[model samples]
Target chain A: MTARNLLLGLLAVLIAAPAVIGAYPLAVLILVLHYAYLGIAWNVMMGFAGLLSLGHALYVGLGAYVAAALYASFGLPALLGAIPAAIVATLAGLGIGALGFRFRVNGVYFALLTIAFAEFTRILFDHMGWTGGSSGFFLPVEHGQLNPIALRGPPVLFYYVALVMTAGAFVLARSLMRSRLGYAWLAIREDPDSAAASGVDVFRARMAAVAVSSALTSLGGVFYAFYYNNMYPEQIFSMARSIEIILAPIIGGLGTLFGPVLGSFVLTLLGEGTTGLLEHFGWAAPGAKQVIYGLALLVIVMVQPAGLWPWLAKRLRIGRDG
Target chain B: MTVYLDIVASGVLTGLVYGLMALGLSVIFGVVRVVNFAHGELTVAAMYMAWVMAGSLGVDPILTLPLIAAALFAIGYALQRHLVEPFIGRPEHEQFMLLLAVSIIVLNGLLLVFGPDARHVAVDYAYDSFELGPMLLDTVRVYAAAAAMVLALGLYLFFRFTDLGTAIRACADNLLGAQVVGLDVRRLYALTFGLGCALVGASGTLMVLMRDATPILAVQLTLLAFIVVIIGGLGSMAGALVGGVLIGVSEALAGFLLMPSLKSLFSYGLLILVLLLRPEGLMGRRA
Candidate 1:
């Protein structure tokens, strides 16, 4: 029940998943990993540093649009496109953090600030002509280019790429939790006043948290654009999209390393299963998945406020030290 | 010149209605100390209800306002008594999460029952406008604005003079003190929430006369309400009114001068400015 064992088991299943399953199921797995990556990144800021942002979509949209626009318009390589994507997202995060933190806009006020900024960005992008506006940006698929390094390939290749990214993010989150900055985040989360009184540079630590979290989230945005082969500001920057990203870490267990992964898998599998079942029975349920997610969040908060991962860890004795 | 005057006049009227929508949010925050993320969903639901009644019974939206408000009051009361009461004493973040859950449920549930298509209620005076001097104004806008102002004034007077209103304010100011004075704090919580829902429901009925009702509009409306609340100052009724009008006018002017899409940018920029320069809001009492 050690962390290493769990990770190894997960990797084995993922590596063998495409071989055993159909393309549709593999796509579902990719979706799960995508959310897992976002959840982990978001947790660093929200669960660790106590900055509740309901608008992480700003970074995701910014990254997606930048990468998509660059690749489509300028014919830039996708790998190199990530640099601008990450920088833009990070700088935007820093600007927002400075505006909010400097003004001492904490708690729900800070959350509102993030939502407002995201909405503003969405409207801005919706009108901008270069990024295709509401028409959407699509990366031209080079007919025969199977470039793994550039992140250009078939769905299966993208699936493995997503797995690798998710695994890498997991390691990053783990190391972060054990690092000095991670401890600082924990301190700030628990109590900013006490943490500052104890000589933790609260503002610096928070700004760093926002910067790192936003940078990581933008990578997922890049993957989303390339994997889906299109980027729509409306779809990527929607409030629902941001809510979807946060729900996984929340339901899995906020601040826990494996929580996002576990939550993502459970929610995604359940969602896919429900869709499959509905299709089989010949029923139409448009918002069923969201209904299920909402119920899951409510039940978790009401029944196990700390999240399912902590309770599961205790019962199963996995990561007992954690 | 006339065009600019028309925009400003319409903006002021719309601002009054916006303030009315935000009044319930401010009241709930002031009395219950919980931010209801589902407030917009409640408003949308009320709009749909008004729409249905207007369509079926052949009555005006104004006529169905009382009925929609009553129904929303019942729904809000039950939700507060059952779903929200347990978490009232928890941390602010936990309460926030609970309300967010409520928002998701209500929003998607509405989407489930009513498809994603936008529905509008047609009235006799839907497109009718009257000219005043060199400016023209929509009749519905003027009526909605008047109703909103009247409701705001009524709420302010009720809070000032009524015993139940005094008890609610007492609870807001000092939870323990209110309880020690033998006030039914739990009932008051439910009542406050119900009253807040009723106010929002009234606004929704008025809104259906002017705009289309879509499930997705709930989030936008919720954000708009928050903007109004923040601009006016949180937990202040008067602030909500002033803030709403200010935002409405600014948005109209922005749309006229810049582009229509940038109007939200103007409102958000105003919010950030107020947060940095005067977080207490224009009419909010210094705490």
Candidate 2:
């Protein structure tokens, strides 16, 4: 069983699974994939580079809003709009990465600083009338259910599209992790001073990783808006949204490529199942979902602080406990 | 001039309350190095407790400080000793996840128990106003502000003078060193958290006097506290106070000077600017 064969087989099943799952289930899968992509993107900097960012939602919102505004105002095709939006977001991420790494603001302070940048952007969007301000901006909806080539139209199409994006993201991250740059990231993660001493350009490495991670995350966001046919500052540029991206990777396995996908699956399935169960029984509350999610995090950490991926990997004889 | 003076006065008062909230956060971080995302929720709970106590005992919530603070102190100690203490030496990332989880539980638990409806603290003098020159201040806001200032000062003095305070500060400064010096680092950890909770209770009481109590205050107020903490400097008491003052004034001035809807945005923008310029915060020591 070659790794490439395994990957191809998995991709094939994913492409087909959406067609069978129908619209409602596929929609859920697409949301999970979006988060999975974001998790992978964020894991590049946060997990691999050992920098925590509580505000990566900024990139996501920027990507979505940028694409939507460009398309709606000028009637531009999304294929082009999405690319530019992602580049803008990537540039923003680089700007922040430069500022933080230059000043040596690593660890928790870096997380807080990321959050500051996000909130700052949210405020700016709230005031920028051209971005539709606080009322929000809506993208043109393709009403009729049509087949999409890149998973852009029907829920099933979106699911496959998302699956491909998430799959590509995972493969890219995994390969990158095993490369020289990846080793430099690992060294930076272990100890920046030592990594610097060993000839690793710690600052440049972190900044590069952040730029790529945020750019990819923004690309996910661009797809997110086109898929939903809407964009809003409050929803996209939120601390909660950032948490959504961070949670998946952390839950699955912070530094692992497969972690985000596993995390998204577990969190989404568990959340949906629990919510479905509750809705059926009429046991609904405003914030109960968050409570349940929190409890899941607590339970996971207490029992297996190493995260779900590592735990499962050990059980499957794929890896031994360190 | 009168309007400006009134705003500044009000902002300073509000700043005192925020300072109290940030103080607890700083203390907890100082001791355990855990960000304690649940700190805001605990403060909301304290406010609820104060409201409940006032209603049950027919005492002014302002007067019920001792009881509320004591009860909250115990709750804080218990939460720290049980939930947070276990994660003390865990990997930094795991600790954040754990704290975030606990925060979510506490927030939803509050919603479940109290529901989504805003809970108002019924006080006789809540609306009474006190006038000085051409400026008028709500009596409760004034008293709350004054009480908060006194409490903050008292706290500053306590941390500066008392043996327990010194030990806690010692632990905060260097956990390993404190243990080597025969300080019960565990007890100091719980004490620091307990003190933080007590201060939060006081802050909650003051907040109720100035604003309505709601479950979602946990979320909003926590964000505000984070802003204050970051602006002031992490783990610095004076920094929290100064940060609180600056945020309060900036929020007020931004609302008046700029778009009415963007006061929060303005303060957050300031935070980013500060980070870009000085990542250690306004008054924080560089690591």
Residue A70 accuracy (lDDT) in model 1 = 84
**Which of the CAPRI classes, incorrect, acceptable, medium or high, describes model 1?**
medium
Model 1 vs. true fold: TM = 0.96
Task: Kindly report which residue stretches of model 2 are placed more than 4 angstroms away from their true locations once superposed.
Answer: A1-9, A145-152, A319-322, B50-59, B111-119, B173-177, B233-239, B280-287
DockQ-derived CAPRI band for the predicted complex in model 2: medium
Output the number of the DockQ-best candidate.
2
Q: Assess the local accuracy of residue A138 in candidate 2 as a C-alpha lDDT between 0 and 100.
A: 86
lDDT per residue (tens digit) for residues B1-287 in model 2: 78888777778778878988888887777666778787788888888887777777877888888778888789889888988888888877778878778877888778877788888887888768889889877787788878877888888889899998888888877777888999988888888888888988889877876767677678667777877877788656788888888888777777777776788777767666676667564345653
How much is the lDDT of residue A146 in candidate 1? 93
Q: In angstroms, how far off is A294's CA in candidate 1?
A: 1.2
| lDDT accuracy of residue B45 in candidate 2 | 86
Whole-model lDDT values for every prediction: 0.88, 0.80
Worst 10 residues of 2 chain B by lDDT: B278-287
